[model samples]
Target: MSSLGGQPILILKEGSQRTRGRDAQSGNIAAAKAVASAVRTTLGPKGMDKMLVDTIGDVVITNDGVTILKEMDIEHPAAKMMVEIAKTQDDEVGDGTTSAVVIAGELLKRAEDLLDQDVHPTVIAHGYRIAADKAQDILNEIAIDIKPDDIEMLKKLAETAMTGKGAEAAKEKLTELVVKAVTMVADADGTVDTEYVKVEKRVGGSIEDSEIVEGMIIDKERVHPAMPRIVKDAKILLLNAAVEFKKTEVDAEISITSPDQLQMFLDEEERMIRGIVDKIVASGANVLFCQKGIDDIAQHYLAKAGILAVRRVKKSDMEKLARATGAAIVSSIDAIAPEELGKAGTVEEKKVSGEEMIFVTECENPKAVSIIIRGGTEHVVDELDRAIEDALRVVSVAVEDKKFVAGGGAPEIELSLRLREYAATVGGRAQLAIEAFANALEIIPRTLAENAGLDPIDMLVALRASHEKGGANAKYMGLDVFNAASGDMLKAGVVEPLRVKTQAVSSAAEAAIMILRIDDVIAASKSSAPAPGAEDMGDMGGMGGMPPM
Candidate 1:
């Protein structure tokens, strides 16, 4: 309160909390760095996994960075911003969530040093921007082109993505499935659509039992037990229309004057059902997949006609079946025709873990496919699903971009070197920021080394010296966490899509810059407790609805 005019000035709410200037910066940086440290150890091929148990005691064990951060239950706003960087990385590139967060943490760590030296945040942000741009250019320059049909390279990419997870034990088999799935979904225009590749997991068998189906797998069972368990040379019909008698959209009143009238009404309904069945039969469809409910009478007719039918299929599964079987989804039974039927080698209901599942397989040159994942337990299968999901996305990225870079922290070291050289030309306090940015990039390799139980300083020094050797082959050298030695990632069969590197760097830098610019944090206190004396008149402390026990 100011006493100048014997008056009081109240600007902010009494309970509102505020922190500004250097305090705000340091608090935010500390929060961001703390978040980074949480995921830092889960960064490489030998990275350890985190077992997160939720409020319900449900456990999640995985080393995937995004999964770890997502399960942390973070509450601090600045820490949540760091989580956003991981999410953005995951969404954009499907890999490198750890690298992005680690870089963001290191950037903020460096920025704190610069802040202490009185270098303006704006200047540091500008220098980081330059460093980020140069890093992307260096990434592109270092990336090698891969043929979309290069199965070997694609296998390496998929294996690299799956190595540290539960799927590593069977990555060779899983890689083949990934490649096949990707290849099947790649259109003639070279665009890969991952949606067409479905992953279905069931816990029982080993991971090696996982295989790619040439067509889609509908999780539903056959509608009728009398229906054939298997159909060969199946002519599949994809139907969106309901097989039962649909109710009238508008409200209606029906009065049956006699019992015979009710019988006649049911007879009419039966005739309509028979008519629909006749249309499907005439269309040469031996198998039926319905998106809507199928009446019992319809199933009987279909089974009698030697046709297999599965009902209550999901809309997504219906779409995938169409792509896999080359069938067109027909809405009306009257429009059914021979040309509308899709062909498949077999439509069979097989018991998987005692639960029946419909497998539509052997579609010639199918545009869509499914990967059936089998594991000894639910957790293993779930982790494998996550691993393969990453592989699928990264493989698609490589196919779409037709470019990949070596993994194992090689690119970070190479970029750090190039960025430092570029920093020299831009002389000023900004140069120090650039140098800090360059130093920040090394965290990837250093963390990789530390997580593998190796000396980070020695590994980084050896890595930098190897890069300084300057050759096409040496450029591919990176810290091999598996052996705790520097090796050629390219020859070691460790590769990643180029987009992962570029997107990780850009997103981390962007997030760091955004966090650096904040000068104040004003948090309004939560609403005050309910007004006093608002309790009900009938207040009984667990005795009864009476005043006393």
Candidate 2:
């Protein structure tokens, strides 16, 4: 609002609220820090799990960072941005979400101190840019080369990912299976897709009961009781079209004046249904997976023909079967061919947990596979599923990138040490920002030590001393959380994909810089709009002044 010649000029609407300058910066930073703190303890091999209950009283228990953050109800804009970084980190590298969020929070915390010292937010942002770039370089420099054939190394990476997730009961078995699943589906050029590896869970047995299948498992049973439950040397057919006779989509009436006329119509319908069953028999497909329903008559004929069929299969399951059995989906029954039919060693229907499920197993060199995850309870199964997924994602990432860095806070310490040296040479007000960035990196090691029930200062001092030894091996030295001592991570088999660290640092810095650059926040109220002609009601003094002007 402004005044000229004793008259007021109102600009904004009546209910808008605005905060500018230092107040806005502090509020945003504080909100972001709260988000980070919420997921802070869910870090490292000794990290604790979080049981988050929602408004409806549904409980989620896990140590995964992205899961915890996503389940929260966030309203503040800046806090939502913090959640976004965790999502980005999870989407890109599939791990290190907690590390990314925690680092971002610490950066803001340090920058808040600098702001109190009267340093400009722009200067802090600029210093963070320089520091983030240097940190990425340091990460790549300290990383060691890996290869797709590094099976032992890949398993180690998977093990490191699942250590704290309560899947330790079968971590070793799951690690081996995770690596095998990834490598089996991985292309020769190093592309790995999780879509090809499905995780199916059930509550009945121990997690150790989980096993990998060589092909897809459909959650469906045979459409006919008269059909054979098992077919060996199965030639499978995938159909998208319905086996039922086509009916008029619009309303119509059929007039029958004589019994002979009705008999003729019934015969023709019988012939049409028989013709559809004949097509399947002609194709030599003993096993059928249909995307649409099969008529009752067609099922009877199919059963007589010694064919096992499942009707109304989902389209997604159809695509997976196509990949698993090397079958081409036939859109029309007339287009079916023997060569287009997929081959499986055996197709069988078996009852599991009181429900019938079909298993298509033993395809020669199958491209798609399934892992049946079994647990004694629902919550255990859920946790195991999460752990296996994280392990699978990390192993695949390592295979594609063929590079790894030491875990257990090794890279963070190395970056903290190296960045401090770089900051000294870049001496200025911006130097303070670079130093702040370095301190933020320490949060990882510090948190790891604290979670492990060790004195953070003592462990950090020992960790820095180990890195200060000034050798190639010194760079790989890190805190060993299990042993509660400093050790070389390379020999300890604590390792992670290089992309995880690089992506975390880069994203955390971007979020920090974005939050720092904001000096104003304007929130408009959720009130209804004014009348259509209200803008022109200028200087109408009282309630009785203007009438539809």
Candidate 3:
């Protein structure tokens, strides 16, 4: 041990000749592992909830790994890196934040043991990378191919993800809706893009019983008492600008000496407003999508003249509707009657369950996509939103790459078996890394079994033995193993281990090797006094841009 300035330095007697600070590497590794273990139990649907309380006693309970890790008030620099990994995983996959943290923790634990044996950080990194590569190969072999008609399977997959979220039934229903919505949006080219589907929820009624309106919904009251309540064969106009007259504030007094002056002002205002409405009707538009406020009198007049109106449209939705309808969005009433009002399309509503799902499909428009989500109690709706976001990510990945695997804890179990087989062939330090990786993969199924009050060790042993006997992989308690593709029974109480193990091994290996290359963490030194216009000094570090801890 020696001193480099004020920092204590540790000089290894072997391996690379580079000198390093004593606490830097080890401290970071320890911190990363600690953070990872914190979120480990919050893995699958049965995952335990983490209650995060801030200094003010504001409490937040969630099973969302990224949310939990992000809200956690961590002080250690190493732990922060682990949190970054979770964030990256959340951003990329929209799921797996928990898995990433768990894998990082496991890897760091193994690294700590290797360091104890003087294996060196560089060597541990090398071995981990090799093991990860082998694990990924196993993952690729186990991904079950998905088909367009596998709606029930998709529901099962989603249910596996949403079981403990108080929306098991909702998840199934929403999954079906999502599948149908995506399929409907698939163009003549046999491809489905997210742009073609739009899903929305409002507070007026149950989302389950909601209807898919051919046109957009506007939460507004009739502009005038005399305006028609409903307009048929409505030619809609989508206006991005204000429909009211502009005004400037000024101190003034009005003298009502005669009714003639009042009548003149009133006439002028009415003429201007009616002129705007007339122009819209003249441009082959019988309806209006107002992004801004509309005068009650103007709305009434439009309604009286048989023009339909929808007000307070969101800018984003307004643009989308405009694109879908091929209607021009005008900035002012003067521009309302442009020759490009596009064509008016039919709007209808369909009811499903007890929720309302609004579907807007434009005749010749290119942008098309559907949003299917669950709703119930307030918390249920919030959780459903989170689930929908995750579902969207998964769907996007599936549509884009044309492949995916069963999620939940299934993949982790599958990966372990694959890694174990690969570890048997690799010798030296690399073999140790592979064995560690395999053990890490087993954590999920082990947790699942333990959570179900079964002896995890016994279940694992039985699972392995059954697989060795040429039995199928999946085994639910007291259930027969049925073929995943066909209804035929493959074996009693036995399921294929390889399929589940493959996903776990692949995702783990990919994530682990991705995080192990970092060799430095840097922080900028602050000057005693600030320079003119200089910003505050900040810390900078790197863990090779790896996923969370």
lDDT (tens digit, per residue) of candidate 3 on 320-387: 66656667777766665556574534532334334432233443543444353435554445556656
Give the TM-scores of the predictions, in the order they appear: 0.95, 0.94, 0.71
- Go through the candidates in order and give the C-alpha RMSD of each one to the true structure: 3.6, 3.8, 9.8
In Å, residue 182's CA in model 3 sits off its true spot by 3.1
Cα distance off (Å), candidate 1, residue 507: 0.1
Candidate 1 shows a clash count of 0
Candidates, ranked, TM-score: 1, 2, 3
Q: After aligning candidate 2 to the native by TM-score, how far in Å is the CA of 402 from where it should be?
A: 0.6
Question: lDDT by residue for model 2 over 1-549, one digit each (tens)?
Answer: 689999998777888888899999999999999999888888988899999899999888999999999999899999999999999998888889999999999999999999999999999999999999999899989888998998999999999999899899898899988888888888878999887888888889788888888888889899889999999999999999999887889999999999999999998898998998898899899999999999999999999999999999988888878988999999997898898899999999987666788999988877788888889888788988888888888998999888999998889999999999999999999899999999999999999999999999999999999998888799888899878899999999999999999999999999999999999899887888888888787657665765533
Query: How far does residue 474 in candidate 3 sit from its true spot (Å)?
Result: 7.8
Model 1: residue 450 alpha-carbon error in angstroms: 0.4
Model 3 Cα shift for residue 328 (angstroms): 5.5
Task: Report the lDDT tens digits of candidate 1 across residue range 354-413.
Answer: 888999998987998999999998889888988998899999999999999999999999
Best-matching candidate per TM-score:
1
